[model samples]
Target: MATTHHTNETPTDVASNGTAPTSTVSPETLLDYYRQMVEVRLFEEAATRGFRQGKVGGYLHVYIGQEALARGFLDAFRKGDKTITAYRDHAHVLFQGGDPKATMAELYGKGTGLVKGKGGSMHLFDVENGMWGGYGIVGAHIPLGVGMAYSEAYRETGNIIQLYLGDGAIHNGYFHESANLAGLWGKDGMCPCLFIIENNQYGMGTSVERATANTNLGSKFDSYAIPWEKVDAMDLEAVIAVAHKAVDYVRETGKPYAVEAMTYRLGPHGAADFLEQYRSKDEVREARKRDPIGLLEQRLLDLGVTDEEAMEKIRAHAKELADEAVKFAEESPEPDLSELTTDVYAPETGLI
Candidate 1:
């Protein structure tokens, strides 16, 4: 009989040293991480409110429980690197140094928003900050992200693409085709892309267990010859530790890698998914116990690095920032009628 003794251990946990990792996050970094997580939490909450208030149009998918995934993975992000993901992309943009006001304004469909409100909530792009854009179609961006990495490899630019996709995409043809090409090109050291699978346990309402035959998402990379691993994404420190190594591996080898971030989404899939028959309330309450912000706060207290008063202050400031972003979105003006045809195509040319 096969026996697994460490089923409860996080992927980043030391193999020989119990469940506690040997590495320690600095007090300064811990505090900053807290600020980032809280801000995302508040900002996403505000966005949800806006959606309910009928301010936002199109599909709305906020990154509520997935903030730690962005906070940790993007910590390894270097200048010139590119990031592309699906619709739930606000957190990635903000963590990539995107402006909160602009992001929120986009959700509100204002002209001053990112992409000038042309690409609402689902398509926020800030190329200067290394974020390609949030795509709406499932598994569709896989090929595009791979192509971007191939471009970087061809130019010898030493830049990689952090291609983020949900677990659901792995079951589709888009992932298979794109990953196969990435593997073949990577053999020639021509594809430097890190595939981050944010496995939030559900693809819409269908759980991974019900969808996947093997259920080990990372091992799917083996079929395409890509090395892969899993990370405890809810633990921000753990994720950052593993992310640095993975980021370095792709950069040095100019090859593809995959990371299945084992995390859970603490909120409904979208604003309208009220009857969450897919999961129970008890399941959600238990997951909340491992909330990244809450975990970090407890860790800080255990280390005596920060007091409760200071933690409250940080949270207060996060709320202030969230309030400011919402206000900015509310005050911003909608795109004018002329915008309908302005960004639809390339400029007119004499020869054409």
Candidate 2:
């Protein structure tokens, strides 16, 4: 088995060892990453509070500790790129230019939501932003992502698809089927998809060790002849570096690739998963030491990108945005009864 390791080195340190940092990514981009990460963290924290207060119903899965993984990849997104992911998707939508007010209103089941309050937390969608939908069913979106890539290729659009899935979804037959087809389709240069496996070590209560005979999640793509790699999710720079390379490879070669990000969920699987019976507090505590937001904050300071005061100001601004989102949701009206039958089917003219 390949050994998993952790690192505290900044991106510059890693590059200085031999590989130089890419010249294209500027200091402004790095600062923006830090700001976005802070915004996501604050947003999720507010969502958790809202869930506790009964503002949000159904299952609530906040992207707390896994901010860096999404931020890293989405930062590298281009005009023709599309993205899809699982239910833990609030951050994904927000980072991709989805309206925070509408997202929060969706959580509150208000008519002003992105999906008109019908989709709620798990089904956020924004076609304009190229965010398809966040699937509630485990592994269901895998096939959909591949299908989207195929459609893009068929249309000769040269667009890339970014498909995100959790560690647990890999065990599903849907994932395997999609991978097999992605491999076949890539042979014709028809599938430019980057399958990102957000391996947070557990699929709900079960750890990867308990769930799989072979725990190297990235290597699972080997069966389909797809290239794969693993990266430390705690480090934004590391993730950004790898993400740029992966996206470039898919864009240039028109093939599928996989990246297993070794990350951890600092919160319960959902708002109701209070017991957390599967893991110990010590394990959670240890993981907190490598908190992605904190890691990035320190890196920014070390790199002289910003000072402590400026960082704190960013944190305050993020919190203000999150607070305003909640207020927007609170003020937004609930979906009217007439809305029940409005979006049930397409118009007679044709499916729009």
Candidate 3:
């Protein structure tokens, strides 16, 4: 997949993927929601800086503009709730309460990383946060999330699993298989999972319109009789509200729900892919007009958050934390090669 990179743009364009529009939320909620978005943005910027300075290694995907949707879902997630996603998973890790330093160290392939540096930028895990490691294979992790939901239900834990997939995964065979199973189990009150589609308008630079025969990704869940809706990814408050509702619905009904978040990537799939031919700079600039962080920031200001100094302090603090994460990663030790032979098999390994 071709990737594109662009400079940050102000006043990003905001759009909704749903058929019906949602009502407005309070300003106080908006401010808190924006805070989450800002944290994600600052963290990504710091990660990018780390990558350029060689403090971080491997393929890096920065979730700068799409922070609102991810953070919103995190805010809605309950304790012991689970989350899973693909290679583009840094933001998801942070939202799941994984230590930022550990994640940075993982990117640098340091043993202090979340997965003991065994998994680089693509694989982040913090089981305590109910977050499984990011899977490299497209759509492969969907079944894991579904199975987790099944187990949670069987154990009567009342926990919900949030399964995230990129626009590209929707076309994969695993996607259909997982969704069908999720729907079947959900109908019988055996599944407690939320299927979240982070449709950033591109599947590795291929516009959703160009690649999808059924561009209405949210409605596709109807075939399985699973309830679903689309949310405006650019608005943090909107996302939080929608996510809260969805989470509540799934928890109460013990069913699976799908939410399509309409957003833009605003960066290449990774640092290596120079996105040029796929999307124009002007198009990126237009999308930037609806940048989620900026939108939420303005909403906070409108909500009587007159403390400019405090806001600056928050941003600065986030940047400092990111810097510390980079330092930790740089100083952390690498994984020993000898340990690779260990943890290779479970107690009941069918084969030696």
- Per-residue lDDT tens digits of candidate 2, residues 124-197? 99888878888999999999999999988889887889999999999999999999999999999989999999
Model 1, runs deviating above 4 Å: 1-25, 348-352
State the lDDT of candidate 1 residue by residue for 215-270, as single tens digits. Answer: 99999999999998888888887787667777888898999999999989888887
Residue ranges of candidate 3 with Cα displaced over 4 Å: 1-33, 347-352
Best by lDDT, which number?
2
Name the lDDT of candidate 2. 0.85
Error of 3 at 48 (Å): 2.1
Candidate 3: Cα lDDT at 95: 68
Tens digit of per-residue lDDT, candidate 3, span 1-352 = 0011111112122234543434244555455545555666777777787777777777888787788888777666767788999888988887666788888888888888888877788888878877786888888998999999999999999888999998888888898888999999988889999999999887876788888789999887888888888888888767766777787778888999999998888877777667457888999899999998777766677767646886787688677877788788888889888656656677478332
- After superposition, which runs of candidate 2 have C-alpha atoms over 4 Å from their true positions? 1-24, 349-352
What clash count goes with each model? Answer: 0, 0, 9
Report the lDDT of model 1 for residue 147.
Answer: 96
TM-scores of all predicted structures: 0.92, 0.92, 0.88
Ranked by lDDT, top first: 2, 1, 3
What pairs collide in candidate 1? Answer: none
